[model samples]
Target chain A: MYRTLVGIGLICALVIVTVFEVTFPIIKVNKQRALENAIYQVLANTKSFSAYHLVGNNNLQKVTDNDTSDIYACYDANHSLIGFAIAAQGMGYQDTIALLYGYSIRSESIQGLVVLQSRETPGLGSKIESRAFLDNFNNIEIGLDAIDNERQQPLELIKNNSKTHTRQIDAITGATISSRAVVVILNRSLSFWLPIVAKQQEPIT
Target chain B: MSTKPGEIIVTGPKDTDEFIKGVWAQNPVFVQVLGMCPTLAVTNTASNALVMGLATAFVLLMSNVLVSSLRHAVPKQVRIASYVAIIATFVTAVDYIIQAVSLEVHKSLGAYVSLIVVNCLILGRAEAFASKNNLKRSIYDALGMGVGFTLALLCLGVVRELLGNGTFFNLSVLPGNFQPWVIMLLPGGAFFVLALWMLLINRLKQGGPRD
Candidate 1:
């Protein structure tokens, strides 16, 4: 009886392990495809370029594209620099909210901010993904302090005290921690990438 | 081994006490400390807690019945691993169903749906009662436990949502400009609410073994 039981147990274990191993690769492939599709959607209007090659292994890259403000640098069919995308991240209450900002090298400012992922509370912290909130970044010129490459004035949201067309965003009411987290992450990411972007750009008048 | 369903001896509390024990008494979260992940992870809002509780209850019911029926054949040494695999299969089934039906809710709940495999409530039921009792008794125990868990999650969800967002299940009850306490939605909020609940329940119980 003992020997029979052990044999059955081994068989069951082997079957389970084999099933998982067989399905693991397929699962990974599906997840990767989904992620790629999401990123492509965020980086809209990619048809203007001939290529969309990933820049580095870090998974965070500065890309240049046209008709976009946050563009860092993009290349034409002949490998010429067109625009750039500045990627930034901020800490939210539950998880880091990654933003893909498209900046135009020609325009020299942020085009728009797209929230990639945030684990914030639904109906509350999730407002960061809403257009009403993200619209705040549209066409805002990247005006960080040139001295030591730090921002002169950090971007923030003043809740219920909206000043229209200012660089500041209106913070989501009652979600100040989450709101500040996004601001801090956005500022920090932009700050980190500003120097790298400056190094890549030619001397602009 | 030959005992029929409902024929096994029940040594614990009789009648409604067994049924009511889980409410806040032998509450799975506060008293027994079972199902910690769901309680902590899903109680961000009232809606998530409700769905999570129902899902867990379904899994608990099925696992209890099956385990009780098969307790004799499950070899003693490998029972733990077998029970896990069984419970995980049911959890995976639930996950796919949820995903197929409501993509939005699935997105909100995220990986917590899969983490149900490790929920201690199902495993505890399997070990404590299912392994000893017949199928009918096991079903009753599982139902009681499920109701208990749902009630506990509901309580937590109601408090957190009302305090954090000034609403229950997204129905705004608080007046405009309530200035919600933001911490009620954070992980810290889950811990504090659970601890306070335990204290309150303890006081109510007068130091008795929670239900």
Candidate 2:
């Protein structure tokens, strides 16, 4: 009889612990959401946007129709439109890294970028998240060639360094591969978004 | 090595022997091949690897001791469930502590923190060592095993970071003129490093497990 009661008591103790365990994480879950939203606002530069609309499923804009990327679009106060920012993904040393980059049709340049996901070796290729690395895009163009094409060739980093590419940006020293991969993903993704931007820029009566 | 019916006494030097066995001799990842998921996932940085190792160690130590203390009381059919519950509680505690102290590390680790509850090494040690031994021995064994796992993660983190970025812990370790291997920062690079590391460890041990 005592053994059965002790077993019941132990089960109840476990049940209480489980209940407590399950409840607090739910509260923490909400706090986490708030923290995440605050971080997103900081990176999204929502203040610069006069008009911000959450688009697509859960307000995420699918960057590639193929669903390879997604981005949050921010418009300036004038509504002339600031830029098309999208989150892009590529393989890093140990894991996939997702990044948010803003391309401006008006400036014909990249405004900024933020690392959204990365499994790169810490203290190394993960520098993609560092402000120094990301700041490289501040004034760089999307198209690579000096010769203008009806379709702009998005900017990318080349290992050998070429002078002819208008869109070329300096790759991070010792992190050439990561730098180049980030550029390629940004360029490939911009190709898809540009047409949309061009279409959106079109006057709709 | 037989103890009570169905219980096997692990023959070793005993006492300190049980404690030191997991560090290099019976390493959970390289030597034992246990707990491969987190071993592969969170080793992108030395800091991250250290945090994960510490968190796992905390859980392993507590769970091993608790399970050992209650070994005889647990019914055979429900032993696994009981062990898991104990582990999950410790994991939740570690998660909260990490979040409170360093949100940066917490963010970097993400889901893998919670996933530690399921890591095989903790439960494996609990069942294999704790179930048959007294609490003191179990604690020692857990600590030793935890150190081994931590060392392995540190090795992976250092190799990947140095090759990929020419730096260690964000400090420039290589010359400015050196070109980093971009592949070292990619998933393919991780797999390559892991394979090479295992092979190196294997060769170092003469194609056999190290003691």
Candidate 3:
């Protein structure tokens, strides 16, 4: 009995390892493609992108090396800088909601948004991906003044169709918690990266 | 001895009976009522249901083949462990294949793919049918069960998707003014749909002429 169990264990391990070895590379490539696609999807009309890492807590510094969690600077066909795509995550209705959003340097507003991963409840909280919810981000202002430290309330989520201000997002009817979560994630992520992005916009020596 | 040492005595049902029983008479989902987890979770959309059904079928087929091939070697006492290990191997393979094939489906199905490891249908078939049958007969039985399971999921997926989202396979089926029943898209809706299907099948069976 002992010998049989040991033999079965070895065989199962061998089979699992063999399969993992064969498919690991393919899986890696697929993941890379997916990330790149998400970046391009959020930053529309982009021909290429360059990754930059963020360092420091308060005074953030951007580095070209890919050592840490990084953001992408997207360029159009003419090689002109279009925007930056940054990944952000925060607590949602059921679990963490991770996403990517395109930020326009010139306009200082979010261009688009794409949810990378989410564990929100289906049918209700999952409406975060719906066009009606995402359309609110199109050129919506995220000016530095909206940060909590400053006078303005950071990125407010209003009732559906009640978005009278540029900084306000319309919440899905039955997904109030999820909608608020998105706003909170965007606000936190934007507050941390906004200064660094502004510094990058300046002409270097 | 009365029987020759290598001579096999077939005490189970005929090969055709084994194959046909799974499709309707002993349907894994409806009759045996096995693998309810996936039956409820991934049947929200027709496409999700179809992909999940195919994935489950692949796992069931491979596990059945391997189990039947090794049935003689596995000891009676540890047979359950051996069957589980075998089923897990096939589930892992199917999960990776699905991820590589279509990330969207993989994402929608999510943890349910891994949950296939625990699905009673595959293990039940392994012990009840595959272990007692030869390789060819086991394959036939697996195919029938897989097809039956797929058909059952499709039944629920069609009704749920049509009512919940006002669409079939993501295409608009209901008129513009039609309001989708939001509850049909929730977890409760899965139970309601499956219950209705089982009731319908039961009523049909009872109403039909006696076999």
Give the distance in Å from residue A159's predicted Cα in candidate 3 to where it truly belongs.
1.4
Candidate 1 lDDT, A63-94, residue by residue in tens: 33321323334444445554455556667888
Q: How far out, in Å, is residue B146 in model 1? A: 1.4
Proportion of the native interface contacts kept in model 1? 0.02
Q: How many Å off is the CA of B81 in candidate 1? A: 2.0
| Superposed model 1: Cα runs more than 4 Å off | A1-52, A55-94, A100-114, A120-133, A139-205, B1-25, B195-211
Model 1 interface DockQ: 0.09
Model 2: CAPRI class: incorrect
Instruction: Give candidate 2 misplaced runs (Cα > 4 Å).
Output: A1-85, A89-96, A103-108, A119-136, A141-159, A163-166, A169-205, B1-45, B88-118, B151-168, B173-211
Best by DockQ: 3
Write the candidate numbers in order of decreasing TM-score: 3, 1, 2
Best-matching candidate per TM-score = 3
**Predicted complexes: DockQ each:** 0.09, 0.08, 0.50
Please, what is the TM-score per model? 0.62, 0.59, 0.88
lDDT of 2 by residue, B138-161 (tens): 888898888778877777778877
lDDT of each: 0.68, 0.68, 0.81
lDDT of 1 by residue, B1-211 (tens): 1112222434444643444555544667768988888898788888989889988988888888768887888888877876776787667767766655555577778899899888988999889888898887788778778877877887788899998889989899999888777777877888999888877777766865546
Candidate fnat values, all: 0.02, 0.02, 0.37
